[model samples]
Target: MAPKEEATNAKNVATQHSQEEQLLHQLPKPNIQNSKYTKRAVLKTLLNRDDGGFALVGERVVVGGWVKSSKETRVPIFRSFLKLFGVGGGGNGGKDSPLSFGQRVQQQPVFSTVTLQVSDGSCVASLQVIVDSTLAPPGRIMPSGTCILVEGVIQQATTSGKHTIELKAEKVLHLGVVEDHEKYPLSKKRLPLHTLRNWAHFRPRTTTVASMARIRHELTHGTHTFFQNNGFLYVQVPIITTTDSDEFSNKFQVTTLLSNKATEEETSTKASGVSLESIKASLKEKINRIEELKRTDSNREALLAAVQDHKKTNELALELEAEEKREKAKANALIKPDRLNFLDDFFSCQAFLTVSGRLHLESYACALGNVYSFGPRFKASTSQSTRHVSEMWTVEAEMAFAELEEAMNCATDLLKHLCKWVMQHCHEDMKFVLKRVDQNIALRLQSVQSTEFEKISYYKAIDVLKQVKDKNFTTNVEWGVPLTEEHESYLADEVYKKPVIIYDHPKEVKPFYVRQNDDGKTVAAFDVIVPKVGAVIRGSQNEERIKMLNIRIEEQGLSKDQYEWYLDLRRYGTAKHAGFSLNFDLVVLMATGISDIRDVIPFQRSFGKINN
Candidate 1:
């Protein structure tokens, strides 16, 4: 072969070699940091409760999770046995070695390992997965929060005096890739809970929010368990009702119905009189529509004159017009209140989303003896405080033949059950929230669980407020007047330093259903005031006396006829019973030490804002 032919063959071989090398570069390139690798690691075995990781040395496993942290660094990789001779390289080329100095240097930053706390929805706590750099190059490191699948060997993470457990990755599969890693929202830096609230849709990815969510689930489960274990029956109450439960807050009107079928009375219309001229005009209109003409009325005046020539038909037309006007007037007269009665409006009388389920619970309690309703309760309160929300969950329980002390015992037991449940089941989450959000969370929970609440009368609370020497009271502490938030907070937070149960409030200050004391000045009522939250719960040994109930109803200025069903409970088979409502969100916030009640609920609906 000629020299030219040989050169051509060499060029073809070189091209093939170049392509192979490019393909080889696509595989995982190892760095000094992540030289050890396991193809896969079993998440369940690794993050299991008893046995942490399942991978014995030199075992292969698959690991799949989201990236938590990623970093790149360079480490010197020594080459050539001749380096033992203490020979050094020059600027570009080595002085005595075969390779150049530039060739010895790694082109990109070296990556060692990536940490991912992965969860497959099986558990609350995520498994910490440390992935070594063998499967990913510097450019290949996925961004924080990027989902990934990997194949690796389970081994001790580092060979040199390192005891940490990690996977030695052989290959990494990008299940979903983030092209740009720098702009990821979450970072190693601590974020404020308020800032996390702004990104509520993605806040659960955060540790604090995730912990709160778990704690919330536990609380819900604990509540259901507590009610179910007790003899109390869970009952469903009407969300939309005609009667207001508590008259203090306004109710949202319910204007829509499920089976919104149109009624014949609404849909029916008067049938047209069979007029020969109208039939002919209708046929012509249909014809005109099909033809799509601009106008065929060149002889409209002549047509009108021809019709007017018949005096009998003209008289009939005038009679029809007068009859139509009379019919229209009759229809309009039938619609007295609304324009045609709003066309099957489904709203004849006023109805609203209920403020409380206690009234319904009372009816159920009268029938079932012991019953409770736990569901979303709505209110139209305009207060813009952190404790106030448009919608809230309430646990309203009623028991027959029970006094206020029994009610208080039930409240204390229920609260203790929740605290114990959190301590046993949600310990991890409780720890996270207590450390990050509020350090006093543990103490608060224990205080509610272990300690007996301070019992004081409403009059006593006022006296205590008057006696305060250190802090000046913002609100007036007068008898027979309603207590403000500032007044209640001082009693619970500063004066008592524990939960204060203030009972026997003024009859006018309390609801109409509260039992009137013998003196007729105070009622058998109680308010559970906590330190952080002013009033978390309220209850009363409801008025069981018919004549006294009537007097109280009159005093509250409520119509007696409207509350006859509630008043009937007093009239027939009256039992000395009491109940209370626990604001579910406030309870969680109080337990977790979160200042804002909004943080405890998933989607908060406030006076002016509704969020997803």
Candidate 2:
């Protein structure tokens, strides 16, 4: 080598050696004595800090849960919700753009990160931090969701009037490792909630679900304290029940029979062809007679009308002929009609799951003088929306000798108490969640506490809705029409822009148990709508007089047999009572500012997704 070249190489080597020595000196010094701050306490302290930006953007935040997902095929988290949370598509002016759909679509919030850690104990030792392959260093399996300590900074994020903040990790310290790692259903690539139904066990590891669950916990605690302090008894209602409280057909039939027994019953019924015979008998009796009546009608004026009537009559006659033929064929086959012996049925008796606890609490109100039932309610309605759930926890309270006015006052006080307690006790949890999921949750709760809810009658709300020119809703919401979600949301989120209580609904739309007002047009029912949660509380004053209750049951054409006990409540000790069923999830959804209901419930039983 040339003299000059050799001299330069030696100089560079010395410089490199000095740099290595400096790096060694800068290595982090571990604290020898481990402090005793529990995970809970540390989390609280992190949240209690008013400078949330420090922990999220500067100070490291090490969140360790479980392996919710891995880097295998999982794309960047941003890719999953880009269209929903992204920028740049705004006013691009495409004629067919989503913005032109008359409603502004919510954009999914974006987050940026540097490191993600996944680990197992033996092969992958503790303290291994994974880096992004494209941008930074090669990724490593430190541990996914496994408990780790990380150092990071917190920063505020804002876009499109919405605000959020998150922790940006500098260095991650992987503590211990967990084995037998299970693949969490929530992956970096977003999947529809229905797809994640089977893996509800791991949904909480997802940021959205975790935030929701925490909010749910906080709301539940708030509700308990709200009633406990308000002199309302916290009554635990039964789960497996026989009474159809809601009187809605959306009840799941409880059956204890094994699959084999069901098969046997099916086979026996098929062999006898009893279902076919029953259909044949009904068809034979009704079709021809109705057809003859239509043919004999004298109101027909036009030849076209006469021909149309003849066509209908012939079709019915043919249907009756077919039914008779079927009956004869069944008799020739020597198969007797099958009888449904309820006693012999392997499934035995079927009972309904409680739809709403309000009625049961009403019963208690009559017996115990004043009572409340707070428990989980089951609904079989298949509505796959942002706010519907099959199984939900509810707080239903009944007050004896209370009128509609008194009921409204109680609901307001209860709500205020709930908001106060959640703000007080759940400050830390709420703070942590706000940092992780929603930034405006505290502000929402603060508003609830600070502002007095506006109260309006149902008729006034309709007048407000009628003024809205957007979408021209065809449901024709007059003073007596049922309140659709759109109208309710507009009242709470748009017009009032706060929690609202809408009362005095038309009796035709309300249930029979509701007390009819002196006007004889509307019932004493009220629905409380929170800003974002929509309809959160539904309640009404009960018809206390036994004679009135019985008349209502008959007027509504409800089977008096199914309501013996409900009637007994009035016959024994009737009082002018009022009650409300507070949808607990909705409370949390509002308190936490969560946009979706699926996030609030752990292992949620949503529509079109049944667990095996």
Candidate 3:
């Protein structure tokens, strides 16, 4: 063991270590974030590792991806800078170079194929071309949501380690003119989820968004098949309804009266023997009282003095009148249907986008034995972050003759089935998206296929979260608080690192229909959470006894008449039924590791923006 021989061996070891790191980066990192992680950046990061490995930066090479950066000069005149060198200005014969893709095109052409010839002069010539849709034509195209095809040879630059090739445009074919581009406000760029909210139409084109949407679609089908195979009947729940089943005091009112135009008298005038003349008299008296107040205000010395001093009181009044008239005109623009009043005219039958399909699904579950409701649900909650949304898809399943444990088992099996099915179908998209999806698709499918998810009550979950190290949480875990995202994330990501079913939430936190456990303080509720995504699935064993359901309704202080049909489900033939809800958006986020709820759904419909 000579010193010289030992030094040589150490140097060889270091070299080999660097080579291994390069290979690791080149191979896909599964279950990682989907966007903002470019291959080159990942490769560079891996190569620059300081972990005393073989420095293999120069050995490995990246082949291709869409050009994230173009090498265009910042000089006011790019041609002039090139001319300073030995090269001629534009073309070999002094012809002008073609305009870059950023230039706006009047109309995108419509054709079967577009050929882009990336020759020696432009940036496209020195890079791999990604042919995608655009808003306009190829030449001088501003790259607005435009679609195109690319064909070119893969070339490399010897001096720099990075890949540099020319994309020769063989043809530029415009598909069609975007008549209302603003209406379809999507662009060909990577935007933050918050910014993408403004461009709902185009957001789905991004790799993360496209992948999430596809995953969600696959999960939806998986859910339906899982229930169908399990002998559960698929139920179509009613969207427009008079029933306030949960009686949460959040149901949007469905009335025929014009909310703005209908007078208070018209709304409350259900007199036993009152005449129309009496109603008119009461309305006139109220108007007169308002007029009297207005005159009194006008006569006030302070108001009169201020108006006189300002000398714009009359003008201000006139302006106010005009503004009020304009508002009224806008309000009255739409004519009310003969059968419908103003409120109903403005919005058809205050029938809301449902929050969940469980209530209506219960009716079918009672009649059909086992039933599940799967559809888009709307919620008006203002909480906005990585998790919550104003509108989302929910899966609510009801089972007759099923208990809480049975419900929990159903949820676990359904989740495993969904994960398995998605991995089997979405392999290509998974490879295309690369890392950032935070999933080892094969491993997840394999693990879920063989393993049963852990079932723990809410109290157990709280204990698990308490023991989790370095877990940052906003809300303290008490006996009855709803599980916060931090608690859920920690439980799923750190403690379990697998699917964890949390059941028996407090009745105070759960909705009215949730069956009361023997402890009275808790309800038979469950939520299936996994690593990276919080609250992917939620469900409850429903209170089916008419007396108990009515007591729940009374305890929640809801009007019984509003939910008579819901009661009828229990009255006719009630059974011990249990169900669970699957947050399809969360499923997509969990499946793809997409952080934003907006990007998870195609044609996102949520607060601030609703894309048609």
Candidate 4:
């Protein structure tokens, strides 16, 4: 090819590239963070602008955020002059722009300005803000965590940096100065997650926690989308329920009994000033006086008068004693009528924070055909493990006219949908997690979404565990025993390298609600164990036979009277139903590759650990 022809082709390529850039800026963009309700543009909107915020130059906008870092710099006189004229450096335009280059110099000895990196927790990116010291003092807005709302014009960055555009503050609309910079919890550059947990109220400002928040929001949205699209009604179950859904009994009892008892005890203490013993002593003294009168051969009238006084004192003592007994009885009324009775409680019956919503959701599914409940469930477990939190959100779904196979399919589909949703919609946060939390998080999620999970029975799983000649598990495997976390990890992480569904667990280990298998030794229950996080989902086919359910309830030593309402569904119109419950926190843990379940939640409530 000749030189002229080659040059012409290069010129055409350059022209095409220029046109594409122009078209990119002209395309319609999403209204992500800028809205009339917001009254200002968020950092996410400016940072994630379609044209990398370059087209936003010369546009005046208001922004509010906390200062992540602040620096004051001095500029030379010649550079200042060039910036004022908008000739040498990058500026929005000429004098029409809102001080795009720098602020007009006054009587100050040196040309100084403060540049702040501000973030609003909307996204991981922070906007660079240039504020003239005259509008807001450097000392006031210099510290990290100092909040400010400012009106500024977007301008091309004077110096090349991560951000394409910078905000030139024309007016400081609001300034929330940090009083004690040294004492601020977020002032430090880096803090461990455990340390941040202590300052949970302010931890959202951190990049890790902020990213986790976005991940959680997207996961929650994805959950609702999956269920709603699959014709599942979003039914709400009671958080404080009258019966325990599981046999563990690790339930936080919701009652006013303790307070009521305290109040009654206080009233009883205040009611009686004199002791029963003191009254008896007074009666005895009066009787002794009567006896002395009689022994000394005093007048009959005097002796009779003394005897009458003694009788009156004895009657007073008896009245006092009776009042004390009544007070004791009133105090005893606050105690349980029997072992499980809570008659004196606020609800007049035993109530606890629900451990699972499957039972309640089953009732809804029986009527609604398909239903789901998503809310926080509480456990009074004392385990201080990273995975065990006192409060965790669970997503439980029940399907009517469905068996164990359908339930397993539903669980698998839901997990896959969530994984794909997070990968697509929460790309930014997932990237952050990949960088900070786990290196292989994206790959793990993709594998889970695409791979077909392996299913095995309880006996098979036990056999596989026992056959592992090279690996020794902490908990020994047995035929009728529940699989521990160690055993689950080996199956998912070592053997399959993916999720595994273990079904037909031993009846002795499962709850009474599970349908008894034909063998009579195992129940139609399944647990979905994933790598890193074991048993994220637990599901089973419910027992539809009233007699079998009653016997199981009795076998577990649970009161049939308490579960009579649950039995009514089977007695009236029984239908085979199956359901599964997924721990939302555990799902998040798997998605983000965060080892500790506590970190995934906004404010985790764990054993002996509760903070704001």
The CA lDDT at 282 in model 2 is 55
**Candidate 4: what lDDT?**
0.86
lDDT accuracy of residue 328 in candidate 3: 57
Best candidate (score: TM-score): 4
Candidate 3 RMSD to the correct structure:
15.3
- Per-residue lDDT of candidate 1, residues 1-612 (tens digit): 999999999999899768755654564432212223744443534544342332243456566766655555443344333355555443345453435552565564443555554553323445444555566554555466667776766554443322334666667666566666655566545677766666677667666666677778888888889988998899999888777667777777665332232222232223444664684465555555434432455455654544444444455557766666665555444222333333445766557898888888988888788888889999888887888789998888999888888888888788778878888887667776777778888888788788789999988988888887887666667898888888888888887788889999998787788888888799888888888887888888888888888887777787787788887877788888899998888878876888887777777787877657
Whole-model Cα lDDT of every candidate shown, in order: 0.70, 0.64, 0.60, 0.86
Q: Write the per-residue lDDT of candidate 3 for residues 427-539, one digit (tens) a residue.
A: 65566444655546556556656776778888898787776567557887777778888888787777777777888888988888888888878988888877777787777
Residue pair clashes in candidate 4: none
Q: What is the TM-score of each candidate against the true structure?
A: 0.69, 0.61, 0.60, 0.80
lDDT of 1 at 330: 51
Model 1 scores what on Cα lDDT?
Answer: 0.70
Better by TM-score, candidate 4 or 2: 4
Question: Per-residue lDDT tens digits of candidate 2, residues 460-523?
Answer: 9988888888757757778667888778888898889899999999987888889888898888
Per residue, candidate 4 scores C-alpha lDDT tens digits across 221-307 of 999999999999999998988876788647776777765664646544346566778878888788788878878978899988888
Q: What's the residue-level lDDT of 35 in candidate 3?
A: 23
**Where does candidate 3 stray beyond 4 Å?**
1-144, 147-189, 247-352, 436-450, 464-472, 605-612
lDDT of model 3, residue 270: 32
